[model samples]
Target chain A: MSLFGRQSKRDLHSLAAPYALDALEPHERARFEKHLRTCDRCTAEVRALSEDAVRLAWSTAAPAPLAMRDRVLAAVRNTPQEASPLGAAPPRPHHLPAHVWGTEPPPPRRRAPRMRPLFAPLATATAAAALVVASLFAVQATRTQDQLDTARAQSREIANILAAPDARATNERDARGRGIGVIASAKEGRAIVTLSGLGDLPSGRVHQLWLMRPDVQPRSLGLFQGDTPLVTSGMNDDATSLAVTVEPNGGSAQPTSQPIAQLALKSVGFGE
Target chain B: MEADELLVRVAGGDQKAFEELYGLVSGPVFGLVRRVVRDPAQSEEVAQEVLLELWRSAGRFDPGRGSALSWILTLAHRRAVDRVRSARAATEREQREGMRAHHPAFDQVAEEVEAGLEREWVRHCLERLTSLQRQSVTLAYYDGYTYREVAEQLSLPLGTVKTRMRDGLTRLRECLGGVA
Candidate 1:
């Protein structure tokens, strides 16, 4: 945002009310804000009026669609934030490619195998490390630097979730043998998924993730291009498992196909 | 944790802090946007933009400047108004208003019990303002109208509408301030 606007020399004090209510037009707002910098009394009044405006805002509280949480969080994870003048920079550690999968293997604390099989040969693996200094949730190792650069803010998030005390991993393999690793933190109500050995998708199809709750409709986490690590948040208490479905292009609001892989979270039905 | 504390963490790029913050603020942000923008789809889009902006600009938040909730709502309201002012959105909004006149809007579901009480409290506070003051504030705020437009809508003098808005908001601040 531009810190300074074209300074208005004349008395624009009467504009304060219209300004606070956002009744002023753009140029008018700039002049008032500019004038406000010099006038402490006006600033004090605007601040008080704005607090009332917040109350007006609160009076109309509406629940955003429940699904929006995951979308926004997913977006937040990848989106780079602007610098804060007051903030000390948070450490952002890169997950070196070699640290993923095989090196310094995290003890697999394999939980109950909640499986829905099209065919019966089930396989399971869990990566429950002391912390995620090494891999399993490697969006970095698998994606291009451009993709990784975009997710600079998220690299730290992926690390934090993986290292969370409640963090534990569960693995599932698709029909084509692509492995999807989900490391979830029940305490944080978030998850990071790493897809490795992904096969090419048909032109119109994409992979979509869902939080499969027992009685309610599944919540779509987001669509994935199948190359990067996926991070999703706002997992409520009832969501029993994570499911992946093949969806048509922009992705369906609801899962359109049978889940290629379903792995129960470490919740009630997931008896160890 | 307080919104300021959470915002500090968010500025430092903490996703979990951002999550808790989102839970607290999304309702007001989305509701206020919908109040001005009218269409649910467009409102959602605008709300998302505002939330993303909060992330991108978290570092710019100054605790001394204002409360986090006020700062966020101000940003949301400004964005919603900007959308309505755009030529295309302004034209589309007129059509929607005309259509809405014939077919009344479907009632939006009331949210949680806690939020209901807050709304009731604010409603009670709003009742304390004079009718003209309340009309001026609501017309400009909820309708996303400029002072000129509000004056036209209320058929009052511009100066009169401006004074009413200021008085209404001042009274509203003290009344709501007691509870908050």
Candidate 2:
């Protein structure tokens, strides 16, 4: 049975309204967020709304002062941009690979701004503010680094799955055109598929994914919509291959619509 | 410079960064608060407080989650809302009309306005909303009032206000060509 309530669905539109404005009550906010995990339609809708709201800042803008710019520049001179990878001394030139060429260290420089004693308080505020900013930078730098690491890990996993010894490739098509897909072991099986622009879905509908082999009918992994990134579960040893289809909200038990994305593995070492 | 970059510089104890950031965002921040709070002097004070808070809390900003502009506006919006709501029951709200706050910080926002990237998409979307829809969204968002408060302020039926807000935002999302 569907987990959603009728009032919930009716409230869906209203719920989205505050979310669009970022005015949702805490409880209502949590409820909508949980709903967002499954409701891609609402997710897409909310994003559009947020962007719309952001534009308001433009309509009501006033120019900042010239002195403020000078203040920012002067204050900026006090902070470290980033810790130098190489300390103090300049690096001796070396004949190395392309990646190493630009990594050399330069001369040490202290570019602190010259100031009046009376402006010490301002300088202190500047220093304190810079420290706050540095800490913020560190936090953001870590997050960016983490995101890069995650992307690299996911890429490596996909590469390993596709390059396995038992890998097989197949070409299949539904209403959409044919494309190549590879599956290694159904146990180790993973596929990476890409499609250009697809037609838009209606308000309540979503595109669902399916896995199919020769023996059993197509089984669903979950629902996906538009061009969002989707990762499927690791196939069981018994399962053979995969196919994809666009279906309504919760997806269907069987193939109710034509597949938009499909793939079959090449015979490398084993089929059993 | 971008808001994120300014925020980063500010976080590193750059008073110039704070000043720049204050200059850059203060107008919208102050204007937004002014629109909601409706007191020039109080709005400027709030803007200064907001800038100081930004300086203190610069470390908490996550650029990946939202834009620098959005982050500052969110802070401004929250403070404005809090200020008005708390002051709602007090007689001081009436006395605020004549007192105008003159902020040196406003020069920064005004300077940026000359070379700012206007979000035309939002402008167009907002224009499409009905007058009532626009009023409700502005009051609720800029002021931080509850839906009940919004209804009371407009003297409209609560259900009608809710529906208008919902429909208005929905159309806005559509007009803007999608959500975030």
Candidate 3:
């Protein structure tokens, strides 16, 4: 009995158990999800079977090593609770080049295209070339539109964070009183670090952000390029300060250089 | 506070609630990952990831969909399965081809070692399944093998494996009702 033999609802229904278990092949999973959008029966079955699986999960419960509890609680203290609306967009892939912001130069034109006019009648070839150029422009236009959409979605995420009631911003300045950086943190532990006036670095170096809590070593949040704002979801709630240091590219396991600047966070709004 | 209520507080950025929720679910979450990954160190890492994710995404949890424990365990299971599947794909492929030729039939002795009443009930329910059904369910659920891999391991047709799993889970669901 081939599972895919029929396109009927009953055929898709049989997949509920496997689907809930994450056992379906990617393609089959996709198909079932499309069906699941409308099939309440399958949805109910999956929910029920999932409860049963959870029971089986509980039956195997053994105490996690004691150390895990400490680590998990410490992490929770540092992590932000995400607002539901912010999760609507699928997470953007990390480590994407800055070109996703549409800043990269367009590819150079092929030299062969310039030479094509010599062999064909100049007028006819020019007309055909114009058509090709128009098509290429359309493709580039589509790609640029996609980049714009992504930027807009990202901007919305930033706006949502900033608009949070508990949001607080602090400016960090260099020795000459020049504001070099800003850190915005919320009660939820979400932080956005934005930098300015730090001229571009030579190759093999990047700016890294660290969260410094009393009685704990600074933890590296991640590295960022250009002057774009860096969003960190796990800024420690107890972190007294945020700092930026220059590190070898791809970032170091720890801050290897003195921080160029640091922002001391003050408890604001609600009583601490 | 209950797990669900604590999760609600966690969503409101209550660190104390988040800590409580972790204390509540971490054991079951770790045990489930340990069962599938069978590596204490890696399982701990995966369990940590799941708990942190739960904290970060607490707002996304809808109590109407399922209990907090179920949702957390499901997430842990998926992450653990993903880790083991990618890590063992090549080795599992080779072993799966000759698995039936050399592997002994599913052992009953292993099932008897579960001492608690809950585990005993699970074993009893699992025993009621046909041997093939039991094997299919255990491989797919506990071992974290995909149905295709389960079929390969058992040297059975994919359709038969799928049918058996669906039937086995349906039976388990009925037998463990109220008690579960």
Interface RMSD of each: 13.9, 10.1, 17.1
- Reference-based lDDT, each prediction: 0.67, 0.51, 0.63
- Could you give candidate 2's per-residue lDDT for residues A1-272 as a string of tens digits? 25577666767656665665556654676687778778878766666566555555545555433333332332233223333222122232221111111122222222111111111111112222222222222322334556545534544444454334333322243445333223233445554333323567777777666665567777776665344334454655555545666666777888887766655432311236
Q: What is the C-alpha RMSD of each candidate to the true structure, in Å?
A: 16.1, 27.2, 17.0
* Residue pairs with clashing backbones, model 3: none
Give the per-residue lDDT of model 1 (tens digit) for A68-136. 564466455444565533122223344422212222211221111111111111111112321122332
User: Which of candidates 2 and 3 is the stronger one according to DockQ?
Assistant: 3
Please identify model 1 stretches exceeding 4 Å from their true place: A1-11, A84-272, B87-89, B92-115
Ranking by lDDT: 1, 3, 2
Task: Give model 3's DockQ, 2 decimals.
Answer: 0.33
**Two-chain complex of model 1, DockQ on C-alpha atoms against the true structure:** 0.41
Q: Which residue pairs in candidate 1 have backbone atoms (N, alpha carbon, C) closer than 3 angstroms, thus clashing?
A: none
Isolated chain A TM-score, each model: 0.48, 0.35, 0.43
- Give candidate 3 misplaced runs (Cα > 4 Å): A1-9, A84-272, B90-114
